[model samples]
Every structure is written in structure tokens, then in C-alpha cells.
Target: MTDSLQNLVSPEEWQARIDLAAAYRLVALYGWDDLIFTHISIKIPGTEHFLINPYGMMFEEITASSLVKINLSGEKVSESPYPVNPAGFTIHSCVHAARHDAQCVMHTHSINGVSVSAQKNGVLPLSQQSFFVLSSLAYHDYEGVALLEDEKPRLVHDLGDKRFLMLRNHGLLTVGSSVAEAFLGMYIFEATCMIQVRAQSGGGELVLIPQKILDMAPAQITQVTLGMGGSLAWPALLRKLDRVNPGYRS
Candidate 1:
């Protein structure tokens, strides 16, 4: 489908496609994709439009040229032989509408993520990675399968100025200024959930991080990650993908 459009889009839009497609591939690589159920979206550079996975394709099967471009209204801007899940658009559009900083929005129904979401405590600060998440985390109570337009306001309200969101009884969500940041944030968020779940299995008292330390996390995060930013590790990830399955870049 993207074959004929190669001469149609600007270079920047095409690059957005490659990176966004890489994100989908990475999600599948880490087993976060919910068998074509969950969605990840990226706003096109210098435009109000965004690119999302074509409905009905497995994450691993998604290619750069095959991504569907849509406006804030969930209407398609690109020609494609696929349909999109309105539920996916409903959730993504709301957040994109409110958060100007979030160029990429990623949602996952990973097992560990949903496990922690259902917990009354939500995300706990039991692991080192949890600190970074807690520094910018928010929680939204689940309100069914994300199809209603009215629910958009509440979801954006709960997500106010936050990068990480735990949808109670649903799953995990991360928004980023870029695709790499969103993917990296989800990686940590999912890992934190996995660690917390395993820690609870021993039935031992969970020693929580002190509030003072949590307060310092927002400032120390760059130092902790050595100022790599989110995309620092992205090249390595893409290289890894290339070794295993390079078709996503097509």
C-alpha cells in the first residue's frame, strides 16, 4: 500500500513512519502488543496529523509505509486497505488533544502491567525504576472499553501533566515527547510492575522508598540514566531488531 506513496509524502513524514513503525515492532519484540488490540500512535512532525498502526495487523507485521495517518477526529488522512479501531482512536485522541508535550502515546495490556493495575495500591515505589514513574505518574479509573467520546475529558483530566498513567482495572499507558521516550517510559513502567508483582509473591513486608528520595527522583533521573535521554538506547534497540526482523523499516 505504501509502495505508490513513496513519492507522495515529505521526508519527515516518512521518517516518522519508520520510527513509529519501529516502536510498534519494539512493542511486539518485548511482548507488549496485545495481538493487534493495543495501539501506539505518533503525531507527524510539524502537523496536526498522526500515524497509527493499521487495524488487523499484528505488531510484527506492521511496516513503515503501512501505518495509517489520521487527524485528531480519528478520520484517516492516508489511503490504506485497513480500518482502525475506534476504541483505540477514542483513547489516543483525548490524550493528544490535551497534552501538547506528548507527541507519542503508547498503551499496553501487558500481563504484569494489568496485574498491578488491578491492585488497590496501583504502582508501588518498591523498585528503583518505580521512582521515575511515580515522579510523573497519574491514575485513571477504568470506564469500559474506551469507545465513548464523553469519557475523553475525564481521561485527559486524570492524565494532567503526567507521562505515566495506570488505568485502574485496565492497563498501563505512557506518553512521550518522542517515540523513543514513550517506548523507554513503557519499558520502565512495565518492568516496575513486573518487579513489584514478583516482590509481593514472597509475602514479605515491602520496604517502600522514602518520600524524600521520591521527591528527588525528578531531578536526579537524568543523572541516573547518565543524561542519555530516551533515544540514547534506541539505536541499539533498532540494531537488535534489524538482526532478528528488519521488515518493520520497510
Candidate 2:
């Protein structure tokens, strides 16, 4: 790491690196990784820059040092031997710029996520986990690959005031003030999609939650963690990641 990188890497940044890398490992372990397609990015400590996985690295191969630093404009800031996907950063940059509270943003193209996004109804409130997502979910129509600068405004508009975004015919996205929150949101969002897929496969009557009950879900889930929020799930997830792929932290 260079002196500038050393200065940028605070205790918080170290923790973020570990958490973000673990998330990538866990996503790969769960078979949710799309080779090198999806991305999970975290804002660097004390700067407008963010850390993203190297363009060509598999999710399981991502380490703290393997991550690349890039500005919101998608310019690489550090002397990384690895290249970055500026087009991949397009969606992430929009969220980072629009949502100041969003310290981390995760995007995935899992089979389940794509299946759910392709559905006409999007996310249905069939499971308890669905409530947590449906309460705060936003939907963005797919405009092919997310590369055009013009897509940013529409993406921002669709993602407005929501933490979870379902990119229609594309995949899923979640944002949080911390890496943990973003990961947890993706977890629930993914779970909801998986459940919906399996349920539809059975061709059985779906038990959808009432809209009134769904409306109360966000507050209720928040209350369970006492406003510390997804940090409750973060520790346990780290423990799981450590057992499966401990190299990510290093």
C-alpha cells in the first residue's frame, strides 16, 4: 500500500475491507456469484473514493489487497496491477452519489434474483423475509447493460427513498450505511426471491402477507435490532465467512 493508501486505510476502513471481502466470499460460497459479473463496493474511509473487486478476479479469489480504489467518476486512484470495470461502476456510482448514507452497495445477478425480477409482480410478500424487503424495495426497468450515463438519472429516480432495488429483467441491488447492512439486505432480498421461485414451482396456492402487515415490517425488523440494525447479523456472517474462506480478510 502507498502512503496515500495507508492514510486512507483507517481502522474503520480495515474493518470495511474485511467485511466487504467476506461478503464476496460468502456470495461465491452460496453459488450466487456470477463469475466476475456482480460487484460489492465500499466507500474508502475519509475520501470520496470506494473500494471494488478487481475486474477479472473471481469472488472467492478477492482479498483486501486485490481490491481497487476508484473515484465516483470511475477513475482508478491507486497503483493497482488489476484493471477495473468502469461500466460496472456505473450503477454503483449513481447510488454512492445520490445516497450519502450508503457507505456500501451490493449488486448481484443470481439465478433467483433474475427469476424474480423477470416476473411481472416483482417481489411478492409470501414469506416473512419478503416483508423486510417489500417494505423498502424499489424497482428499475432494465435498459440492457447499465453503461450509459443517461441511465443514471432514471436509476436514481427508481432507487429514490428505498434501500433495496429490483432491477427488472436484470438482477437485485441493496445499499446500506455499512457493509453489514448492505449484505444483510441482499441476503433477505435473495432469500425472498429463492422462496418465491420454489413456491411457484410447486404450483400451490401462495400465502401472501397482507399489505397492512407488510407496511409495518420495516419498523418491526428495526425494533428487533434496536436501531443498531443489521450489525446484529454481521458478526454471525463474519463467523460463517471465516470458516469457509478466511483468506478474504488478509
Candidate 3:
């Protein structure tokens, strides 16, 4: 590891690393991971730094020790043999910089996510799963692979004051104050898209929930789940990951 990472490894940082690694593994297990393409990153505790997956490793191969420490500019603060991906960090860094409440940022290019993103209406309120996402979601049109520095302002602008962002014709993103929150947000977002896609495939009129009801969805969802959607779901996902790929924590 780099001296920067050596000095940075505290209890909180280790926890962040382990949780982020577990998230990567779990996303892979759920089929949300797109090879080594998409990324999930967590802010380094007590610093402006963040932890991200190394460039070449598949999600299942990401151990806590393997995650690279990087700053907003995407330079690897960790002394790993692997390099960091500047393109991947571009999307993540914009959210982290714009949303101080966001400690973890998860992005994915899953087929379901891309499918929904391509639709002109974006995320329609077609299911219960859609309510959780529609209440606080935003959309950003794809700018041809997210590598340009010029795109940051518009991307952040489109994501203003929202936890979830659907990249038009691209993929999905969720930001949270904790890894669990971000992971759970993505879970709900992906489920909404999957359900919509499956429902549309039925070739019948979608039973979209009314706008008035959708307006009350955030509170209603909280009431139904007792605000434990993340708290409850995250552990179960971890257990699933443990069964399939327990080395993430190591």
C-alpha cells in the first residue's frame, strides 16, 4: 500500500473499505455489475478522499485490501500495482462534490437500468418499487461515456437534491450517506426498472400509480418499512454475499 493509504488506515477507514468491498461483491451477485465497468465508491472517513475499485479487477475479486484510495482528481493514493479509472471517477466525484450528504456513490450499467433509462418517460410510476425511486429521483442524459470534464456541471445540475439519478441511455446511480443507504437505493432503483421492463413486455397497458399517490410515496414508503429499508436489507444482502463470496471482507 502507499504511504498515504498506510497512514489513512484507521478503524473507520477499514470499515468503509470492507463495506464498500462487500457492496461490490453483492452487486455482482445480484447481476448489477457490468464486468469491471461500473463502480461503487465511499468517502474516506474524516477526509475529502474516497475509496474506489481498482481498474482491472472484477467485482467478486475485490477484497477490502484491494480497494484503492483516491482523491477527487482520481489519483491513486494507494500504492497498488493496479491503476485507477479516471473515467469512472468522473461521475462519482461530481456527486460527492455536489452532495455533502452523500458518503457512498454507487453506479451501474445493468441491462435493466439501461433499458429503463432509454425510455422517453424515464422511470414511470408503474409499481410499488417505483414509488421509492420516483419520490427522489433525477435524470441526466448520457454524454457519450462520462469522460469529459465539461460534463460535470450539467451532470451535477441534473442530479440536484436527489438520491437517485438515471443516466439516459446509459445506466443508474444512487448516492447515500452510508454504504447501506446507497446499496439499498440502487436495489430499489434496479427493482423498479426490472419490474417496469417485465411489465411492458406483457404487451398490456401498465397500471401506473396515480400522480397524487406518487406525491405521497416517500412518506408512505417510510411508514410501511419503518425507515429500515436500508437497515434491514443491507445485512441480508451481506449474508448472501458471504455465502457466495466471503473474501470481500478479507
The per-model lDDT (C-alpha) reads 0.89, 0.87, 0.89
In model 2, how large is the Cα lDDT of residue 209?
96
Question: What is the per-residue lDDT of model 2 for residues 183-209, given as tens digits with 9 covering 90 to 100?
Answer: 888888999999999999999898889
| Model 1 stretches astray by more than 4 angstroms | 1-4, 226-228
Provide the lDDT at 46 for model 2. 83
- Candidate 3, superposed: residue stretches over 4 Å from native: 1-8
TM-scores for all candidates? Answer: 0.96, 0.94, 0.95
Question: Best TM-score goes to which candidate?
Answer: 1
Query: Model 3 reaches what TM-score against the true structure?
Result: 0.95
Q: Stretches of candidate 2 above 4 Å error?
A: 1-8, 227-229
Worst 10 residues of 3 by lDDT: 1-10
Candidate 1 lands at a TM-score of: 0.96
lDDT of 2 at 43: 93
Candidate 2 least-lDDT 10 residues:
1-10
Ranking by TM-score: 1, 3, 2
